[model samples]
Target chain A: MTPSTDSPPRIYTAALAIIGNEILSGRTQDANLNHLAKTLNGWGVEMREARVVPDIESEIVAAINALRARYDYVFTTGGIGPTHDDITADSIAKAFGLPLVEHPAAIALLEHYYPPGELTVVRRRMARVPEGADLIENPISKAPGFKIENVFVLAGVPSIMRAQLQGARAFIAGGRSVLSRTVSVLVGESKIAELLETAQGQFPDVDMGSYPFFKRNALGTALVLRGREEARLEAAYDVLVGALSAAGIEGHPGELPD
Target chain B: MTPSTDSPPRIYTAALAIIGNEILSGRTQDANLNHLAKTLNGWGVEMREARVVPDIESEIVAAINALRARYDYVFTTGGIGPTHDDITADSIAKAFGLPLVEHPAAIALLEHYYPPGELTVVRRRMARVPEGADLIENPISKAPGFKIENVFVLAGVPSIMRAQLQGARAFIAGGRSVLSRTVSVLVGESKIAELLETAQGQFPDVDMGSYPFFKRNALGTALVLRGREEARLEAAYDVLVGALSAAGIEGHPGELPD
Candidate 1:
C-alpha cells in the first residue's frame, strides 16, 4: 500500500429543532437542548445551532428543512406524542416530500407493550413515521421515534429522548472530539479582557471565551479554551495563566461554583 | 369621532436570538429564554420563535436579520460584555449596515459607574453601539444595552438581562394578552387524546396542548387551553373538563407537580 499524506480532520456538525408550543410559550423549560449538546460533543459532533419553534406544522417543517440541509445531523424533540398537537411526524413528512405511513415495527412494539386491543386510533398515531424512515427505539415508551435521512425525531420527554439518542449513536459518524479547559480567577471579566484578546491572537486556532459569574457576594470570571488539538489548548491556557500571574491575579485550573 | 367596528385584536409577535458559544457548547444552560418568553407573554407580545447561535459575527447577523424582519420585535441576549468575545454590538451594527460608534450616553454611564481611571480601554468597549440606537438601562451594571430599530440587545447575565428587559418594556407596543388555563388528569395522554382533539375542533380560536408527565410512579397529562379571549379559553377548559368527567375521569384544575 502506498503511504498517504495527512489531511485536516473532518468536522461533523448538528442542529436541534425543539418542536413545542410549551417551550416557546414558556410553559416548559426545555431540558433537552443542553443534554443533546453535551452528548453530541462527547460523540465528536459539534452542535452548531438550535431553534425552538411552536407546534405549528409550517414552522416545524421550515426549521427541519433549514437545519437538515445546513448540518450533518438534525435532531427534533417534542410533538411526537399521541395527542392531536403531535404533528411533528406529518411535518417531517411534508418537509421531505414523503408520505406519512405507519411503521409495522413500531406498531408491533406498541402491540406488544399494551394490552390486547388496547391501542386505540389515537394511541396508534404514535406508530406513524415518514415514508422510507427507520425507527429509533424508545425503551422508556413502547412507541418508537423515527429517523428520516439526517433528521432524528425523538420524544419530547427528556428521559425518553436521552434513551433514543443512545439508539441513534450507532448511526452517527462523529469527527474529532473538541476538548475544552477552563481557568478561573476571582476578578471581573473586564480586568482580563485585554489579556484574553492577546492570548486569542497568539493562539488563533483555539476558541476562547470569558464568562462572568457572581458568587458569595464576589465577582469572578471563567475563561474557557476550546480546540480539536489538546497541546494547542494547553499552550493557550499556559499563556493565559502566565499573563494573569504577571497581572498579579491568581488563575485557578477549573471554574468556580455558581 | 365615529364609532369603530368590533374587529379582531391584533397579535404582536417577537423572536429571540441567543448569541453565545457557551450556550451552544452546553457549558451553560440558558436561563434567559424562559424568562424572556414569560415576560414577553405577560406583556401581550407572543414569542413566536427563538434561535441559539454561536458568537460568530456572520451567524449572529443572519439570525438577527431573519428574526427582525419576521417578527414585530427581536431580542438578543449575550456577547455584550467587556470581553473580546463580546461582539454582539458589532454584529448588530453589521446586521443593520450601520456604522459602529461609541455612544456618549453609554460612555457617560460607564464613566460614572466605574471609579476615576478604572474604565480601561477594554471596559470602554461596552459603550460601543450601532449608530442611531437608544440605550436600554442595566440597573444591575451601569453598562447599558442598546435598541436599534426593532431589535433590543441585552446582557447575557440573567439578573442584568432581566433588568434591561424592564427598561425596554416602555418602548414595546403590546397587543391583547394571551390567557391560559390548565386541567390535569391521571391518565396517559393517549387516553384523552381523542377528547382533546374534539375540544380543539369545537373551539378553533383557542389553542390546546396536551403534555404528558410521570410523577409518584404514575402517569398523568396536563391539557392546557390558551387564547386571546378569557371567556373563550374558559369555555374550552369547561368543555374539556366535562368530557373528562363524562368519561368517568376526575380532572383537576391545574397541572401536576413535576
Candidate 2:
C-alpha cells in the first residue's frame, strides 16, 4: 500500500533466503535474518519474508525464484564460499537460467588481495558469478558478492554479509519507514484482548500487537502500535492508554522495567 | 536420507509454521524456530523446513496444509491468544476442513483458572478448538493449546510455547537422534576447503559444514560433522582433524574460545 507523502511513498518488499545446512541442522544460529531485517527497516524497505533452505541446488533455486518473483528484492545469504557445500552462487545462476562465469573484476580483486601463487583453484571459485550480474563489493573479503537482477547473493558469515549489505544499500529504493510505540500493562492479554481489538478497530491502518510476558512472578502484556504515521500512532497510543486506565490497569510507556 | 544402522534409522521430518506479523515486521525476534529445531533434534526428528506467515487466514491455511503434507509433523506457534489478531485456530480448522467448535475440556480448564465473572466473552474465545483435536496442556496458563492431526498449535510467548511443547512430546513418535561434533580450526575455509571436501567424501553418511569466523584479528573456520551414527561422527571427526593437520592448521574440538 502507498503512503501519503510528497512522492506517494512506494512500498518496497524484500525477501531473504538463507542457504546452509548448519542453520537447518541446528548446528549454527543464523545471525543474518535479524540484522538484515533491522537494516532494511531502517532504510524504509520491508523484509516481508525469509526462507532457510539447505545447500541443495533444487531447494535454493525454488526459494530464490519464489521470493524474487513475489518481492521487490531477494537477498540470499551463505553458500558462496570456496567449499564444496558452497553452492549458492551456482544455484542462483540456475534459478535465473544463466551461465555461471568467472567475472574478470572478481578474479582481479582476488588476485590483488591474495599473493600471486597463493590464489589456488578452490579460492578462485569465489570469483564465479552469474552472467550479466553486478558485483556487490565485499571490503572485508576480496571475493565479491554478486547481484543478478532482483537477487543479491551474500556471504554466509555475518560480518562479511553485513559488509556486502552496506554496498547493497545503494541499489535499493526505499519508502516511508514504519514507526512504532510500546505500552506495557500489568495484566494478562486475555484480560485486555477486547480493549486491544477495539483500539485496533478504531485505528484501522495501524497494527497493534499484544505480547504477554512473565517476569518476577508477575504477568504482563506489551501492547505495540506500529504504522508509518507518527500522529496516528500517538493517537492510537492515547486510546490504548485510556482503555487500560478504564480497565484498572497502569500502562507504562516502552518496555516494562526489568 | 536413510542412515546406516542395524535396522536403518527412520528419519522423521517436521516443519514449523510461525504465524505472526511481529516476526515479519522486525518488531519481534522469533524465539520459537531455534528452540523447536533444537527440541526436534533431541527427539530424533529433523526439523526440515520453517515458514513465517502473517495473521492472515489464507496464508496460515496454505502454510499449514503445505508443511503438514510435506513433513511428518507441523508445529504452529503464535496467534492462539484470545485477541482479534489470534486467528490460528480458525485458520487451522479451515485448512483441515473441520468445524471450529468450543471444546468442553478447554472451556472447563478456562473456567477453573479464572475467577467467577472474570471469564468474559473475549476470554472465553480461548476455549474454541478444531473438531476432534486433542488439547495441549499449558501449565503456566489455563487456556489450553490444541493439536489437530499433525499440527500442534502453541502460544507465541516463549515460556508458554515451551511449556506446551513438553505436553506435545507425548504425541510424537521420534526416530534415532542425530549426533554431531564441532572441530574449530585456525585457518580460512578456502585454505582447507579441499581438505574438508575430501573428509566429507570419505564419510559419506556424515554431513560436514565449514563455517568461517573472524576473532581476535585472526580468521578461522569451524568444521561441524553430523550423523545418525556416533561411530560415523567420530570417524569423520578424526578425518577432519587429520586434514587440518596435513594443511598445517591446528584443529580444536568444540567451539573456539572467545
Q: What's the lDDT for all of these models?
A: 0.91, 0.86
Mind giving the per-residue lDDT tens digits that candidate 1 earns over B73-163? 9999999998889999999999999999999998889888889999889888999999999999766666678999999999998988999
DockQ, per-model, please?
A: 0.86, 0.68
Candidate 1: segments with Cα more than 4 A from true spot = A1-6, B1-5
Interface RMSD of each: 0.7, 1.3
Candidate with the greatest DockQ versus the true structure = 1
lDDT of 2 at A228: 83
Q: Which candidate leads the pack in TM-score?
A: 1
Interface RMSD of 2: 1.3
Reference A-B contact fraction recovered by candidate 1: 0.83
